[model samples]
Target chain A: MSRKPVGNAPRREPIRTRWIWGVFAVLFVLLNPWYFPAGSSRLVGGVPLWAWVILAVCLALSVFLHFVCAVYWQTGDESDE
Target chain B: MNDSGVELAFAGASGITVLVAYGLLMLGVGVITWLANRGLHQSVDEYYLGGRGLGVMVLFFTFFATQYSGNTVVGYPPQAYRVGYAYLVSIPFFITIILAYLVFAPRLYTLGRRLSLVTPVDWIHHRFQSRALTTVAAILMLYALANYLLEQFVAIGQGVSGLTGGTIPYQVGVVFFIVIMVVYSWLGGMRSVAYTDTMQGIALLFGVIMLLVGSLMYFGTPGDAAAIMAANTPEKLAPPDGPGLLRWLSLLLLVGVGAAVYPHAVQRIFSARSEATLKRSFIRMAYMPFATAGVVFVVGIIGIAAFPGLDTAGSEQLVGRMASALANQSAIFYWAMVLLFGGVIAAIVSTADSVLLTFCSIVSHDLYGRFVNRDAAQSRQIMVGKLVGLVAVVVLVIIAWYPPATLYQIFVLKFELLIQVAPALMIGLYWTRMSRRATLAGMVIGAIFASALTLAGLRPLGLFNGLWGFLLNLAICVGGSLLLPPSMAEQNRARELTHV
Candidate 1:
């Protein structure tokens, strides 16, 4: 069994997605009531509009995570050394 | 007998029957795992980490169990009932755990696999070989985990007695399940916990979905809930004010990072069979909040329409009321509720067992093995951990029986202290310049600041006390590291240690 993870794996192009985490932080703030103050009074399909907006953003975020898990291939890469 | 008393009496009998069957099933899992891994008990790695061979499904469910405690089923709805739509923060906070994992888990998993790490403390010891640092980290984990275990004990007693209408007394319920948990854990260790957690996770998932359907059928939908709240409690339907928004954001950040760093959760990252298994598990976990917390949020929202005039304390009874009403509706719903409460008690036990196991590992492997007896046999270490875990559970059960009035105070205390470790764990992984002394200083200052602020009832600017301490913790770690740089060789070693 190989004890060294990055040592044995064949090298590939490093997937640079640190900036995507920044995007997630920004999106977190946007989904909150701070960004859509008017959503409190408004109703979307009998749910609060802010709640709907949060759900939409969460759906988008889940899709983004799915994409990241698929494509973020920096695991076991020793190129940093 | 009164009408409600008659109904509870009927439900009480059903609750006893279901709990007995559930207990048997869990014990069966214990026996099966023990039989499967009979000769391997002598090895700490096999006992504590399932030989690091969990596939994607088991890994995912074990992860699920750690993230969604009985609190998600029992505690969160009441919070939603109190805050209305604002409690939607629970969903995002759960998702943020996965986001926080994104920051560290990939690299950490790679490193842990290569090093054959067994506990979170082991990782810290590897990064900075200070005996003081390791012990402090272990003690902090034990404190938080003990608090966590106590909370589960209290919840287990209440859940059993409440669901059974005192058919099983609170003290009896706590002792009964704690005994079962200790035995199974003693027999099979992490394999038993992981197997039972998968069962409990599935049971809770089914129960939660049934709860949503049953609540909607008996009580009405969210639209009806919205209309009723508009008529009766319009303020609940309205948007949160500026202060409310700030508090929400603080909670989002606090629980996000806080829950992810939980000792058990972090250790699981080291237990995955392969990197692919770990990655797939996280992907599925990212979407679980919708089914788990999101469903419970809707249940709480529907409670506004179904049963009105509930203050926060009274709202805690909302799930019981809805489930009781469902039981009275038909035999099918009655059995369904019995299963739901059964699943709930199981969920509590599953969480408690995980906490207990992690607590033991830290004590035996980190404190005793490293500091007290460096040359102890691996089997001896496992035995010591089991005994210590049993004693701790007994002590915690006593506290649960005669719980302090400030039991709720302890519920918040663990997160505050646990999050203090985050600066060291998160920053140390990526930034090699992080000084060991600086990390220690940051933990000391942050823990003191958070605990003192909590004791004095001073949450400055309405932020959660943990957040306030975290900012200070982060500041110290950053500033202290820069001021007292490590020697050239030390810096090189630190960089080499962190490279993944």
Candidate 2:
């Protein structure tokens, strides 16, 4: 194990990192259900419109997380013992 | 009588058989893991964390089992039944937990591996070097874990009795599964827990799939149910009002933060074999909400139409009602319902065992080993922890036998307190200037505030008490840290500990 401090080591920051917070805000707005006061009359592929909105946004969030996990979430693996 | 009582009276012989088979399978896994790692048992790291060698699959399933639990299978449908489409918050809330991890897990995993940390308190002591802070953190974790274990115990008892009809009493079922769990965990520790977690996760996934298919085959899918609910109970299908939205947002933040900082989940991060493995597991975890929580949400919506006119109390028995109805339909469903019930029980046991094992590790390595005998052999430390764990479980079971007001309330209570620890854990990882004194104050104040509000039955506009606690926790942590800077030595130490 390297006892040297890797704390200040420079690594490439993912370009999408800056927008992650913005994405979270968007999800929060979309998922809050209160804004879309629609009833069962409006349907998307059989789901209530409100529910379909939440589901689609969540699915999109999951895909985004996958991309972030693969490309951006660095854990200093280069410094592992 | 209630639907649970009625279901218990008609529990089938096949369900009991399937339950026993599942129990045996868990035991067999434990024994195999124990034998494989016999030589490594003397070391705390080996027993508690599988020598930090968990691959993506093992880590993923263990994470899956720990996060989803039996509650997701049994409890969630009823919640969906009661709230309608609004309960779909469960799906995003679960995903948000993964997002919460993004804030700290990568850094912590790197630090944990570098330092060879075994428990959450280990990081506490290393970072702060404050006995007061570490002690408070340990006690809070223990209290939350014990509360969590109690819920699983009660659920196990109810699951067994209900699944078997009245053939097996609740007490007998709880004791039977508890004994098997303790024995295997004692033998194999985290390896056993993680391996059994994999099996339990698979069982739960299969069971939910079967239950959903059966529900669709007999009654209908979520779409069909939605159409019926739209006609009969439009409110169930409509968007939330103001207070409802408040509650939904509060629950989403509470679970996202609270579950992310769970001691067991943190330990899993430390236990990953490599950063690559941890990343892979989390990547998989990000999508699991669709397969796991999404399915149950649909099943619950199905229940709203399949069994309409169910009040809140009546809705709690939605899974039992639906499963029993399906079991009566045909032989295929009869067997599938049996497996489903068995899977539920196994899932509960899997979760309880992980909590119990983590509980033991904390007591063994953090409290007794740290304070009582710093020089005690690793084997001796683990033995003391095991003995303490046995006593703790006994007390918990006695309490479970006469459970407090409601199981759901106890579930909420633990989260209220556990989320208080999040500020300290998350901030301390990244902020070198966070004062230990401030962290301790945030925890103390946050816990007291949250508990007080919950006990007073005050929601403050339908929001959960935990969110109030977390807000205070974050505010206090930020304000206190800025106002009361870390001492020079403390700042140096923080940098050292958090260094990648």
Candidate 3:
């Protein structure tokens, strides 16, 4: 149920290939609850410890996307014209 | 699905006044835009895509306003209340939408500029050059967008009636907003839609944030809410177990991809004035889930302690109930809650207007222009699209007025059928060998399979029916593309068009 989505993509590498996508795959998996055992249900800062971890994962994804959009991603020129 | 039992003291006259003011503001934006760009309505490009000249902020807010509809504000908290900590998946899923966009948007944006792609199906017809594939893709988008519009109409009626304490009946409220939305949309087209979206998006964000603050002030702190959950339903506070985990992952996949490929969203991508403008807008969008979905999640969590004993059906009215509870606390909160509800209706119309515009563009550009009369003038094409959209609005308003019991199934089908187009649209963007036949086969079969699963209320293996259908569609289409031979001429033409 949790396999990485390695859809049958063509390997031509048109858009800049980056390690960030691999990083996204890892971050996405961590965002789910499988990695965290439910027995560790302690509270952290008044919220569930696991929930905080999930929020942190989401924040990391957001930060990664911010970085990706600003730096890693590049659409071709003449798109402005 | 009963009412939230919200009856504000000033819900009658003040609510209507705020609504009229908001409507007039939208019309003002339309009039100003129309006057500024008076002669641009002759072509679908100018009328529908805002002449391909939206700057960063307008593009960003329009994307925001269109993507996160009134439902996100009014309807999502009840869901969060029911799901508990597990609903935190909401934020991550929104981020994943940008992930979906990153896969296809960069290249699609480039090609859209070069080819003057007007609708999503415009891209399909260009890529595949198959009448069947293009027509089917157009039908799928039209179907999905129509269902989306119907939901907005229903929401507008409910929001208007709810906010005015039934001073405005649901039908009158629906008709009033529909006329307002159509007028502004017809007057200034996409420019008006984007400007009004900026206003609506700001209002919605402010209202949601205020609601969050009032909820925290009235209900209690996160600590207090946590203590209540620990004492009462401790399971809510824990990480999801096996099936729940599957469902979470499924949601991240389905909603993220489905929304990213939305027709209005695709149009927004094309409407960006420049590549840099689109990039900057997307960067902002990458962060919005935290404010909108994240805040709503916290509000829903606070509700656990605020109102404890309601069953599932009653909990559906949670946001309204909390606003009502907060309004009782203070004078300022009462007025703030009124704006929140008003903003909810505005956001609904904002979303509906965007959908209606895209629906019309597809009718005008893809279906009518391409098929009925290839030589027809652009003004005539736009006119036909507006007429058809008006007819659709009329019929859908009827359905909203006396919604059938099976309407929920139709609501669910929007995403189910819409996702079927993603394989064709996104994959065909890059893969040179992407076969039109395979794509058509995959899209049609996947739609049927997903519809059957949804109608039967089946989610085998804790996965969404759309996800299942999408996987099968992807496999067949991508697999078929891999196996089949591409026409070299077609391939070369695509490479020249895309330059990848």
Candidate 4:
């Protein structure tokens, strides 16, 4: 109870969080296997090249998000000051 | 399935060495814990909860290990392999955990500090003033956690068998890590788990990076992978459509919410050293999916072209088979392959240690101290918790040895049960009107519904998971709270506590 609030104390906005999550949800819908054409692909070395690309993109995106989170999203705790 | 003589011997020797090393480390951890907690600071708060002093890095990694280990590495690849692009949902779903926390964690963190809340049950006990509700929530949390620990045990055995090419028997692998984990967890409590998680997390990251590099070198680029997939099966590259899209979205919702509520994870929030540390760590963790999920997904996708026509079981073995193939190709590849194998084992141990610690804390803090021996000294509570943890590990190892059914199926069941606690943790954070009775009723009904549907092989319409049970759970929690008025005393307490 002794803790004082910090920062601009961004107005509690559940809606904004919900919308951002919605965007990710939409992206998830766009990314799955149902849209892809079914059948076998010829092997390169040993794998399908497109699949590898998707994996790379995912890896890149995940790393990018972690950096963003580390740098931006975090607000210091109230107890720190 | 050919068991070459030389390969078998090499695998056996490596496997034994890894298990022995793991055992010694765990025993060492236990001894450290005993020494640290032996005298003046032997309270439950110090031992079970690490004196509530975890910094952001330790807190984040502890949470990360609990969520990502075992299944993130072992089970997820096969899913990615089977569903192809649809499994891309895994990364976003994981990122959603931080997003979900943003919804209420700040408030909860503040509240936790003020109340000295040791567990999620403490929050419930304070908010609702209902013993029945707190008890039910505690039992449900215990069941979900034990089931989760059991799955880790099962994974340890399978991971060891696969990594070693069956050179280590399943029973030996299960017992080996279980013994190690129990010893260390009993030693330093959360401190030991967190310290070791830092080590485990680093190994998993290094191993996965090495695997990705090795895969690209051995196979080729995505362009190459794409050309191969296009010729063999073009559908693997296409984006999801219709029901596939629906299922993907459902997966995102189910796992995002489900994973965030795990008892172990909630406990980590309590362990944070300062609010700043928690925030910094989360910001860092918000991006971990790239290293953890991103790497596993790449490995799975590459498997598409590298090894084709694999059945479900065969697909699950993709990482191991791919590693084995590469190692056999050259001397350099062989050593790199062994490191990757070691990394995978490290990931499993890291996960097991964290789960075991959380499991012990729950028993010590919630069950025994709260119910059985209410006035027991702090040291006594720690003793009961550690003993319960040791017993639980033994039971789980027995189950792992026999393995009543499939590993993945049991793994899925763990999430179904754990996700039931979401309403109480996520919703109760801000909403003062959420009555304890209502929360309990919703959780119980949801748990029963989820368990029944899973056992009956029922999927609500065409949804891929039993989290449909959660829908009912949420509805009951919301509806019951609104309908049943909170006692005046309860309302006053909530207002006083949550006031900003």
lDDT of 1 by residue, B63-91 (tens): 99988888898788888887788888888
Which lDDT tens digits does candidate 3 get at residues B392-444? 99999999999888657866578899999998788787677788888998999
- Residue by residue across B175-226, what tens digits does model 4's lDDT show? 7777777767766777788877776777677767877888888865556556
Residues B51-103 of candidate 2: C-alpha lDDT, one tens digit per residue: 88898999999999999888999899998888888888999999999989988
Q: Could you tell me how far off, in angstroms, the CA of residue B265 lies in candidate 2 after the best superposition? A: 1.0
Question: Which pairs clash (backbone N, Cα, C closer than 3 Å) in model 1?
Answer: none
| Model 2 docking tier (incorrect/acceptable/medium/high) | medium
Clashes of 3: 0
**What's the TM for chain B in candidate 3?**
0.97
Using Cα atoms with residue i matched to residue i, what is each candidate's TM-score against the true structure?
Answer: 0.95, 0.94, 0.95, 0.87
Q: What is the interface RMSD of each candidate, in Å?
A: 5.3, 3.1, 6.9, 5.1
List clashing residue pairs in candidate 3: none
Flag the better candidate by TM-score, 2 or 4.
2
Off by over 4 Å in 2: A2-16, A38-41, A78-81, B1-10, B404-412
Q: Using DockQ, rank the candidates from best to worst.
A: 2, 1, 3, 4
Tell me how far the alpha carbon of residue B21 in candidate 2 is from the true structure, in angstroms, after superposition. Answer: 1.4
Q: Residue B479: error of model 2 in Å?
A: 1.3
What docking grade does candidate 1 earn?
A: acceptable
